[model samples]
Target: MTCSTLWCALASLACLLAAHNAFAALSVDATPPYIKPCRKSDPELNQCIKHSFEHLRPYLIKGIPEIKLQSIEPLRIPKMVMDNGHGAVRVRAQFSNITVIGATNYTILDVKGNVTTYKIELALSIPRIETTGSYEVNGNVLLFPVRSRGDFWAFFSNITGSGKIYGKEVIKNGVRFMKTEKLLVDFKLTKSKFKIKDHLNGHNVIGEAMNQFLNQNSNEIIEEMKPGATAAIGKHFKNFLNGAFLQIPIPVWLKD
Candidate 1:
């Protein structure tokens, strides 16, 4: 990402996180935070953003290479493990040939300080996610390496989540310093569309049973995956914020 784009993304994220933190601490007692309308020429806000961005570039760059999101096409999964029913069974799968749409639209409600409150809309379609891992049921009573392809659609509304910034203060060379707190985000999924197309494997009976299990339990499976997805998006923003605000001096506004 270019420097300006990265900074803008981080600033936007900081605004989101600050709002979420207040909401969490106040237990809905706090008024929703709003993004301050300020021009690039605005003295305090502009200076703070510029200084903070410059200071954070060092630490921010370190983590950028590590932040990975393949939202475009053909998302590859070397291995994915799913376990349900109190560890009674497990499925290891590899996902590929994925196509997604409407998965990255974020509507910002408010931006105050380091916290931001927003609603995100996401819809995903995986044409085929190949499953080629062993399934073990009840301590290896049923064990086999299977293959399957799934076509799934997931959609949700008003997905609310939170991200909190945590850090400490210190003095270096007689100058006060503040660092970004760990990123904490919370999220949930309500209703969505999930489907499995066809199952293929060596064992006929077990394959058919597994396919039926997935078709019947798609809702449950989606629910199980929601939190991880939410955390991932939240963490993407956190990485932005960390690179923007952490390595350098903390902005004066976040101090309050």
Candidate 2:
């Protein structure tokens, strides 16, 4: 072959190779990764989900602005008067500092297409639940503002729910996507307690009066607050889960 013709042929071959390399870089495999179902019975998967929740630590305790509890119905007190010229003091309450101690029952419901559904139970340990806002002095009771802070223990037992997440495999044309559809959550608050203190403004009697009122009507209080509490908690949970896993792709999250 002539030297000029051979040189031209070599140059054409080099250009063809460069074009193939560029196309390879721009193209992605149409086939998605095989995602094995992480069933509840599967101990390894369960453990993995639980451990993965550590990534959610910063977001979890970031303090919700507010979680309003339902109002307590008017009570027909038995005209019981208090000592030292005090009377019945009706109190309305709210809660804060809802911290979770541990989480369990991490179960993956299904893994299909670009959506993954799962449920996790969190054992929330609220160190200081400030349950005080408004006070109604039914009678002439010289109480110190009726503001009380107590240590509350409650269990969000097996909060069964599922989340819809957009997997990374579906990201096309450099468009990032992360969405969380409505999480159908149903939960029960079990083993709840409010350790009432009997010390307010150096007046043990006034504190005792408030504590007695709460103790006597604990059942009614729990029933009234259950619905609102559950709803607020569910909202926070969904937000945290979505925020935690949105940036991290589903496939990468599961594998990691």
| Model 2 alpha-carbon drift over 4 Å, by segment | 1-94, 98-178, 198-206, 254-256
Per-residue lDDT tens digits of candidate 2, residues 1-256? Answer: 0001011111111111111121122122222221122333444654544333433332223421221111111101111111122123333333333333332113333322222333332222211111211222222213445554443333223233333322233342463323344433332333333343432336556556656655556555544444443344344434544443343333333332
Error of 2 at 148 (Å): 3.8
Task: Give the winner by TM-score.
Answer: 2
The list of candidate 1 runs beyond 4 A from truth reads 1-104, 109-154, 169-178, 195-215, 222-240, 247-249, 252-256
Please name the candidate that would achieve the greatest lDDT relative to the true structure.
1
Cα RMSD, each candidate: 12.7, 22.4
- Model 2, C-alpha of 246: deviation from truth (Å): 1.5
Number of residue pairs clashing in candidate 2, backbone atoms closer than 3 angstroms, sequence gap of 3 or more or interchain:
0
The whole-model lDDT of each prediction reads 0.35, 0.30
Per-candidate TM-score against the hidden true structure: 0.38, 0.40
